[model samples]
Target: ESPNDHINSHSINNSINVISDDDVAMEDVIDADDSAAKHEQIIVKWICQRCTLVNSEHSDRCDVCSSPR
Candidate 1:
């Protein structure tokens, strides 16, 4: 196999590995709402009451779901 072919097969093997470290990490990752209560770093962010998506204090609407603040 050419050098390029070896690299392609290695990448394909890595992609096909379901139990890869990256896949495990992605599965363990917590979403915004899940960590929102734990990570209260942003005290000034305007939390949209409608969608609960956080936005800048200056914003008049939610940045994620686009609900009016």
Candidate 2:
């Protein structure tokens, strides 16, 4: 191919590569956000009504009598 054609093709290829890299980075960021949200949802809190005791942030039941929160 002619020099000008070769240069244009290389430029186009570089542009495509840059765009693909950006898309991958953006996807990685979105995945991280989704993972953080899932972790937050999995953490449950329990507060005892009788003695007013707050259990661990990850506990689903009160520590005193195992009552559902």
Best by lDDT: 1
Q: Give stretches of model 2 more than 4 Å off.
A: 1-46
Q: Lowest summed-lDDT stretch of 10 residues in model 2? A: 14-23
Task: Write candidate 2's Cα lDDT for 1-69 as tens digits.
Answer: 677865533244222111122112111221332333321123234456656565666666678877765
* Alpha-carbon lDDT of model 1: 0.46
Off by over 4 Å in 1: 1-43
Quickly count the clashes in candidate 1: 0
**How big is the positional error of residue 39 in model 1, measured in Å on the Cα after superposition?**
16
Report RMSD (Å) for each prediction in the order shown.
13.7, 17.9
> Can you write out model 1's per-residue Cα lDDT over 21-58, one digit (the tens) per residue?
31121112323433333321223455667776556667
Of the candidates shown, which would achieve the greatest TM-score relative to the real structure? 1
